[model samples]
Target: IGLGVIKNVTLKSGEVNGLKISEGKLAGFIRIRDSGKAELTAIGKFVNSKFFHHLRNSLILATLTVFLTLLFVVPAAYAFSRLKFFGREHILYFYLMFTQVAGGLGIAGLIALYGMLVKLGLYNKLPALAIIYAAGSVPFNTWLLKSYIDSISPDFDEAALVDGASYLQIIRYVLLPMALPGIATVAVMSFIGGWTEFILASLLLTEENQPLSVWIYTLMGGIGRGIDWNYFAAAALLFALPVFIMFMLAQNYIRSGLTVGGLKE
Candidate 1:
């Protein structure tokens, strides 16, 4: 039965327990004893609604973007940390400088660039956001990962190489396992960063393709009216809960990972 129809029922007697029959209503009803179950059902329904669906999709997209970032970041960082190559230090310095300088101010140029892409029929696309988020994450992720990789013992890679393992094989069998802690750190950081990212997402996405942050922004007034504080608060809390949960789940990994490469001498 609908919420409106639920009010039509009247309790009859003191000792009575009967769902009063309605004409064309009352699909189901639980007593006060079943209120807990009813509440759970309602909450489940709400979470499965369109609002939650978009929230869920945005979270998934952010997560996937982070994972893709790690896919490239781990290897790149390992190479930068372990391999000797020309211009390597220069590249690292460039990335550090880029990270330091490329903050909110760089966004206007990026927005204009995406706007041009949109005019070319690529606006509000997931790939665009993914590409942007992935690129934005790389500098910090690479540097963080490089630090972790540098802390690892070169003896492991040497031993693996002496065992006739190819570079790809060594990466898969040796480095990845040893770098788990660092990987977790990068993944968690990237996921958290992308999950709560608003400005870039807002600029890249249109109404139909908007992420939760953009959608939540829409609840505020455009003209003269005040904000919808209630809806805004609810949406904000909902948006925050997943990221909070994600961090809580990864907290153990992050701590253990950080300590994994500590001093041996």
Candidate 2:
């Protein structure tokens, strides 16, 4: 509705009633600014609130998710890529099937997971959240890394073995170096996944233990409190800050990781 009346308005010599329409995209700016004002005006209300604490919780989960994903995915990927073992093909098929299992682990499964966590005394905790994130991410990360690792020549592994270097040493110095971009991709994906995740965070966490996603959810829900939009926008923008930095730092590796995988049999 806001844009409907503006499109056909003929500006008189780039002036609309003495307002310069010729200036930088003022129409779009006005639209955004108008909408943004409501959300941006309450910034002060969010500064010292649970927003920061939730952000810290999110950071802990994202960092731990990355760490755990790397530990589990990297070694699993290397083994799948370089090692020939009994039922290797069957194992790959089973893994691919298991990846499909994640999709079915939806709302019902989330509740069941929460129940199990509560039973184990792990619910409402950052470590519990990180474990969930890592479990969800490991399959795809391992598959992607395996595809990239396979693209690397087996001769590197053979050469390391001939030099009396153990498989672990070869993986550390050779395959790991070759798969650095993929590793960054995995880390970024895990970080972002844990960072933006909402449902589980909201369900499994409480109060200050909640992450930014849930924090923002509650902020948006205070309809009776005339919820401040400025604070909400500020919180959102703050929530996005770390991921933006991650992308800027690993921009090149992100593209390479996605494309380099699946290039070889």
Candidate 3:
């Protein structure tokens, strides 16, 4: 459906009130097309396609993954930043190496991981999948958060210690507040990672437990099947909406976090 009819009109050069139209053929041109039905049909299909179920599963996985990542990373990064211990530097190096090397965890490693998950009856479990995502995230997030924590002054820790504050108190009162930007950064990254991760999600989860990412993949249509580009495109757009909103909301925190964490004081 269109709003106005295209008609030839005579107009002088630089005629301010004239409605100028293109002289050439307009292929696939929509001056004012109403796509409400198409959009509603796509949204209706998405709603009826059990996307909410997959979305819930994804939210669970991403949220759980972020929780687990922060749970482990905060303390680990604090220790790495403030504590002096044997082989501390080497351990940090080891973490970096692991992140660089096993980051992808290649096909063979995935096969082995799959078998292990199967043996443990973790296959298709959302929590188990969250654990895997959190574990994968820990190394990098720890490194990132540690950098931010390092930028904080130790005088706060000393002052707290002098006042008989425990390490936990110092972490809670001092580190956490000051390190919030970096924490936000880690959380955003981890959530995005877990939300969008496909290979592991597809391999480990069944249809009922599949995430929106995997669900979108199924929209592509399988063997001898034709793709519904409109539906697929709409679904894909909706799928990415959450992450986009998250990033936009946390844009400032992420920028500051990266800026500070990238530099050491």
lDDT of 2: 0.74
The best-first sequence of candidates by lDDT reads 3, 2, 1
TM-score computed on alpha carbons, candidate 3: 0.79
Candidate 1's C-alpha runs over 4 A off are 1-49, 222-230, 255-265
> Worst 10-residue stretch by lDDT in candidate 3?
24-33
**lDDT tens string, model 2, 4-57?**
222322222353223344434333222224333211113223432567677788
Best by lDDT: 3
> What local distance difference test score does each model get?
0.70, 0.74, 0.79
lDDT of 1 by residue, 1-265 (tens): 2222223234332221322333332223322333422211233233323566568658766877787898889889988988999999999999898888778546658858776867877777776677677888899899998998887888877877887988888778777766877787788878877777787777777766667777777768688877746556777788888778777777777666555433223
Which model, 1 or 3, shows the larger TM-score? 3
Clashing pairs in 1: none
TM-score of each model, paired residue for residue: 0.75, 0.77, 0.79
**Residue 61 lDDT in model 2?**
88
Among these predictions, the greatest TM-score belongs to: 3
